[model samples]
Target: MAKEKIVLAYSGGLDTSVILKWLKETYDAEIIAFTADIGQKDELDGLEEKALATGASKIYIDDLRAEFAKDFINPMFQAGALYEGQYLLGTSIARPLIAKRMVEIARAEGATAIAHGATGKGNDQVRFELTAAALAPELSVIAPWRLEQFREEFPGRAEMIAYAEKHNIPVTASAAKPYSTDRNLLHISFESGMLEDPWFDAAADDNKGMYVLSVAPEDAPDQAEYIELEFAAGDCVAINGTKLSPLEVMETLNEIGGKHGIGRVDMVENRFVGMKSRGVYETPGGTILFTAHRKMESLTMDRDVMHLRDSLITKYASLVYNGFWFAPERLAIQALVSESQKNVSGTVRLKLYKGNVMGAGVKSPVSLYNPDIATMEADPTKAYDQGDATGFIRLNALRLKVGSGVEQNAKK
Candidate 1:
């Protein structure tokens, strides 16, 4: 009998590093570590060496930054997907992409199983498994965090560190940091440590150092910065007239938004697994893009169409957060959402000042706002007739009048 070859989604973090050794020891199998580079800044530095030292036979460090932005982030942005109207779903959206790539690598490597470090309680496990099942159902999936053996052997990060020491696995994490962080081009998120307490204020002096993407709002410069964002059919095409790739757009806005102390969110959200969790997110670029995109839509989108699409925001957002990025229903909704963006082409002017995003102006060649019809001033040849309102009001009030009359008669 031969041991199964497994591909592990490796982060080179404490959790994944421990999982790498555990998978090898438990299964006695060949392990190929895969790390997706979705713009985690310096986190990817020395990852290959760390993974190799952690007992991985082979390592795959793939750069998927542009794909992450254009395929995952931009489409979700186009759909205006935000969990609970506050969370930008930054960490949630990245998982499916990572899983997709992991499966692809598994097939190429001729591996029989794929593994992930996501815990049983978290959404990432669902996202990873769902994606792998959807794409490569034939391959076996391994989730070490759920296993009793892994839990008994390494109950917590402290124990994992000890085990790493015993095994001589080089790791950069310490229990002192306490919190867990996930970073990418769109945003950065912190969870499950001091952040576990919903009452924890990230703005506190001691906790302020936890923020990696932006400064505190109170520490931001006093001056206001204004910029123009140009859009083409719901996608941001340029910033202040400089056209850029999706990744470049995100990078530019992240720099500006971070400087202005923008895109910080703290909230307790309902997890798909039927529990509530507190999370702090820094979505600097995404915040700017969402604000600018909405303003652009206001200029170009029809009122009813905008309202209709707005109605689906909650469901669309939930689907993304609940690990249904590749689900059929999400795809159907995305189709409708994409269809609504046909005329969403325009420029939006915004002012960024101390964590605030202010809309300055919005204009579009296909704007539905008609000054001739909407103007309050009296016009001799106006497109709208004031006399027509008499009949319009009567027709609109008729239903209410009938209902009120029926109620009054019923009382008699």
Candidate 2:
């Protein structure tokens, strides 16, 4: 009889590394470690050798950078999906794509189960398992952090470190750091550990070392720089008039925006589990995209159409934040969002200075802005209806006037 095989989403991080070894020992199963490279540039270095040495029967490292930026990041950017008006949904967007690939590998390797290192408390458990369920509900999800036996075996990071040392498993286990971070091409997030104290300012001088993508705003260039972004159907396709691939566009914008310290946000957001958590994020390229896209929409979109989309923006953002990427309601909203972008082709010029992103100008072929009709210069050819103001105002104020008269009569 053969041992059962289990596929694990491995990050080569402390938690996943320990989980890889623990799964092998506890289940006596062949554990295959898989890592997705979604533009975590140097993070993928030596991952294969590390996974193999950590008791993985096989190691799979897939470079999904281009696909991740194009299919996942771009669509969320198009929808302007910001969780709680602060987070750019960077980690939220990457999870489903990674889990999708995990299922594909599970089917390929004939694995009966899949596992992840997401703690029982976090939103990732929902993100990872919901994706797995949507794609392959037949495969069992093995979350060690939620398992009582595993929790008792290794109570915390310190216990996991002890277990790893006893088993001669190589690890960089010291005291865990003061923050937890997740990184992809779109953004980098910092939370947990010392960040649990909501009053403790993340911008304090001591925490400067935590930022990876950009420098402090005070250290940014003194002069403002302007950049032009071209969008096709609400997706940014070019920068400064030069057409580039989706990944290239993001990489280019990140370099330019990071140099100027463009995107940095800190907020306490409501978790899907009914608690609030503080997180700091850096989303340079995404910030630029959001500002430019909204500016273009202002010029190209009709007033009512824009209002309708704006009304649903919060709900759309919430759906992504809550890990309902595959839900029917999300799909329906996304359909309307896509339809609204049909005439959203345009170029927006923006000024980036320090930590600020502002629209410099916007122009679109379908722009509804008409300076001629709005101008103060009198033109007899234009149809003017000044005399209709009396009736318009009287009709609008009828109820108010009637209520005022009734109050006066009572007073008399």
Candidate 3:
């Protein structure tokens, strides 16, 4: 009899540890573990040894940070995709890349099925599975949390810890914290534990130390810091007059934005799984870039083109948030967004003070702000025609005039 090979997304955590052993016992198969290092800054240490000890036949620890920034984060940033205008889609954006690499690994490993640690109730389960379905429909997906048997065996975190201990799997689970977090290059999201209560004062000192990316506004330095951002074709290419790669730009901004206590949001967002979930996000670098990019657009982008792109923001954001990053419609929307940003090249100076981002100045060679045409002073040679407004106003008001007349006649 031939045993099936399964590739599991392992994190060396309690849930994944238990799932690793359980998959082996249940399937009687060869288990291959895969880990994607998308800037989970602290979680990558000693993962390979941990996976093999926990019943995985082998392990794959690939660094996907650079690809994550260039492919996933940049396109989302260019679209200005923010779920509910607050969340930067940090957690949502990272899942696709992770799943993408998993599918590739499955093919190389000759694995018949792929598995993830995402629970059924959250958006991640959909994100991981959707990407797999889009990329490799032939591969089977094993979501343990969604299965009746797996859920019945380990109903909660406590049961999962017990299972890991009984199996002699190395796990770092201890006295559980009130909240859980997911981190990547763009942002870190804290949810579930204490944050489930939307009324909890996250700004209080008790909750202050939970955030990794930014500091509390009140605790930040009183002095304001200025930073200059340069953009090319809608992507930030440099900072403070220095050219940098995409990864370097994010790292630099996270540092500077963290020092000044920027990019912190506490909001209750609508989860794609049809529930209201409260989350506190720290997107310091993303917040700065989003602001600086818009400032750059104001200098070079036309009003109608910008407006058209703006109209697509919410829909585009919804698609990303809902795990459709690989969908045809999302690609179509991105085409429109990319075309709109072709002229959005410039430099914007910003002042970061506490939690606020202020635009200081902007410069662009292709700036559409013609000072001569907008001047209040008289221009004899190319004088602006005030009389042009008469016909322009009349033509635009024609529909309104007819509508008003119809209303008055109906009253009579």
Window of ten residues with lowest summed lDDT in model 2: 378-387
Candidate 1: where is the Cα deviation over 4 Å? Answer: 1-3, 379-381
Error of 1 at 128 (Å): 0.8
Clash pairs, model 1 backbone: none
The lDDT values for all models are 0.91, 0.87, 0.89
Stretches > 4 Å off in candidate 2 = 379-412
TM-score of every prediction relative to native: 0.97, 0.94, 0.97
Tens digit per residue, CA lDDT, model 1, 21-68: 999999999999999999898999999999888899999999999999
Q: Which stretches of model 3 miss by more than 4 angstroms?
A: 379-383
Please report how far candidate 1 places residue 214 from its true position, in Å. 0.8
TM-score of 3: 0.97
- lDDT head-to-head 1 vs 2, winner: 1
Q: What is the C-alpha lDDT profile of model 2 across 1-412, one tens digit per residue?
A: 8888999999987889999998998999999999999988888888988899889999889989899988888777767787777888988999988999999999999999999999898889998998899889999999999999999988877888887788667667644467888989888999988889989888778877788888788889999999999988888889999998889988998888888887899999898877888999998988888889989888888789788888887898888777878778888988888888889998999999998998899998888887766667874547556677799999999999999999999999
Clashing residue pairs found in predicted model 3: 178-193
